[model samples]
Target: MNGRLIAIGDIHGCHQEFADLLQLIKLEPGDQLILLGDLVNRGPDSHRVVELARQHGAIALLGNHERRLLAARRNPDKVKVRDSEKATYSQLDDADWAYLNAMPLTHEVPELNMVFVHGGFLPDRSWREQGADIVTEVQVIDRDGRPCKRREAPEALPWADHWTGPPFVVYGHTPRDDVYKLKWSLCLDTACAMGGQLTAFILPERRLVQVKARRRYYP
Candidate 1:
C-alpha cells in the first residue's frame, strides 16, 4: 500500500526488453508489480521471463496465450496450439506450469477503484462475472453487443471506449504502438515483442515508463 501499484503490458516473452523495462522503472521495495499476462510466447526466452517475474514477486494475470496453453496441456486432443507458441510451450518447466496455473484473471486495488486484467472486459456486463474467454481475448465490441477481437468486428469500437466505470481498468493483450488511454481504462500493451516498447503504468503517480525493444523478435 505504501509503494506504487504498477501494472505492465503483455510481455510476450521479450525477456531482454522486460528486463530493461524493469531496470528503467527502478522497481522499489513494497511496489506491487502486476503483470498483465502473456508473459511467455512470441519472443526469445519465455522461461527467463517467468523467472524474472517470480524473482520480482510480480502478480501475473492469465492472458489468452496462457489460457490456450493451459487448455492444450489439459486436453491436447481438444485444443490446437499455435506454431508461434510452440517454443514457449516446450520451454516451460514444472515451476513455470505451476506459476501459470496460479495466475488470476484479474487483480484489484479497491481503494483506487482499479482492476488490472490481461485484456479488456465487456462493458455491458458484470466485469466480475466474465470469464477468461471474454476478458483474456476481447479487443472490440461488435454491433451485436458482444465481446470480440478487433478483426472479428472491424468497424466496432474498442470495449474501453464504451466502459463506464467505478473500477478503472488497466489491461494488456491488445498490442498497439502506444498506450490506449480512456477515461475508464488504460491499455498498456505497446507491442514489445514486435519491435515496440515495453510499457509500465504506475498508479498513485499515474506515470508511464517504457523501454524500447532491442529489436523485433517476431513478425
Candidate 2:
C-alpha cells in the first residue's frame, strides 16, 4: 500500500519472460504486484510462472484460459486439449490446478483508482455486476451475451474505447502489438502468450516495463 502497485500482463506460460520482467522490475519493499491473469498455458512453463507469481506474493486474477483449464481439471473427460496448451496442462500439479480454479476473476483497489481483470470490463455495468462471460471473453460486444472475436477481431469498438472510469480498469486477454492507454483504462496484454513481449505497468509512477520472449512458444 505504501509502495508502487504494478499490474502484469497475460503470461501464457512464458515463464522466462515472466522472470525477466520481474528482475527488470526489481521489486522494492512494500511494492505489490497484480498479475492480470492467463498466467499459465500456451507457452512452455506454466508451472514456473504460477510458482514465481505466488513466490513473489503477486495477486493473480482468473483468465479465460485459466477458466478453461479449471473446467478441464474439474472434469477431465469433459474437455479437449489444444496443442499449445497441452504441455502446460500436463505439467500443472493438483495445487497448481486448484490455484487456477480458486483465483478471483477480478481485483480492484478503489482507493488507488484501479481495477485488475483478465478480459475487458463492460462499460455499461459495474465490476460487481459483470459475469465471467463479460470479463473472460470481451472485446467488441454489442450485448452482454453477444460474442466477440474471442481470439482476435478488429471490429466491435474495442472495449477500452468504451471504458468510462474512476477506478481505471487494467486488463489482459487480448494480445495487442502495444498497450492500450485509454482515457479511462490500460490494456496490458502485449501478447506475451503469443511470443510477444511480457509487459507490466507500474502504478503511481505510471511506468511500463517489459521483456521480450526467449522464443515463440505457441502458434
Candidate 3:
C-alpha cells in the first residue's frame, strides 16, 4: 500500500498500545499521522502520549476528555473526580495543560478534502466556529459518556449529520466495533483503552488498519 493520509482513533492515554500501534504501522517520517484526540485521561502515561505525538509532529485534535482534563486542572471542583491507577488529576503538570489547551478541536486539510476532529462535525457550521458556538451550547455529561439532552439518544447531537462541505469529516469520539462511514463522515475510534482495537483510516483509498490492545489498558 502506498503511503497516504493515516488518521488514528481515540487513544485515551494508552501509551504502550499507542506506541505498539505506531510500530505495527511502521510509521515513516514522510507519513502523516492524524490523531483523533482523547490523548490523555482514563489510561496510563497520558503525559508520554502527548509528548510522543508532539515529537512525531502528529496532527491531534482536542477531544472531550482533554477538555475535561483542562477544565479539571483549571478548576477541579467543577467536574466530578474519579480515581484510577493510571495518571490522574494530581499527576498532570503545567506543560500538560498547556499542550492540551493548545490543541485545536478540528483540523481541515482542504487539499485532500479531509477534515479531522476529535468528535463529529457540524454540517451546518464551519469548523472554525464550531468550538465557540456549538461546544458551549451543549451541556457536557460525565467524562465516560456522550453529552446529550435529557432522554435523548446518545448518538443524537446538534447537526450530527449536517456537514456538506468540501472536506469529508473524519472523527473519533464514538467508538465502534468497526470503522463507521456515513455520507460525509467517518468514525475511527475503536475504544483502545477499553480493550478494543485502535483503528486508522487511509483517506481517499478508505482502507482500514487497526491494532487491538492485548488487555484493558485503562482503569
All models: lDDT? 0.91, 0.82, 0.70
| Higher-ranked by TM-score: 2 or 3 | 2
* Candidate 3 wrongly placed segments (more than 4 Å): 1-4, 76-81, 84-86, 132-165, 203-205
User: What ordering of candidates by TM-score runs from best to worst?
Assistant: 1, 2, 3
Number of the candidate with higher TM-score, 1 or 2: 1
Candidate 1 per-residue lDDT, tens place, 1-219, comes to 989888899998989988888888888999989999999998999999998999889999999989999999999999978898889988999999999999999898999999999888897778999998889989999988898988889899999999999699999888899999988999999999999999999889999999999999989
lDDT of 2 at 212: 86
**Which predicted model would earn the best TM-score?**
1
Candidate 2 Cα RMSD (Å): 2.0
lDDT comparing candidate 2 with the true structure: 0.82
Model 3 — TM-score against the truth? 0.79
Model 1, 124: alpha-carbon shift in Å? Answer: 1.3
TM-score per candidate: 0.97, 0.92, 0.79
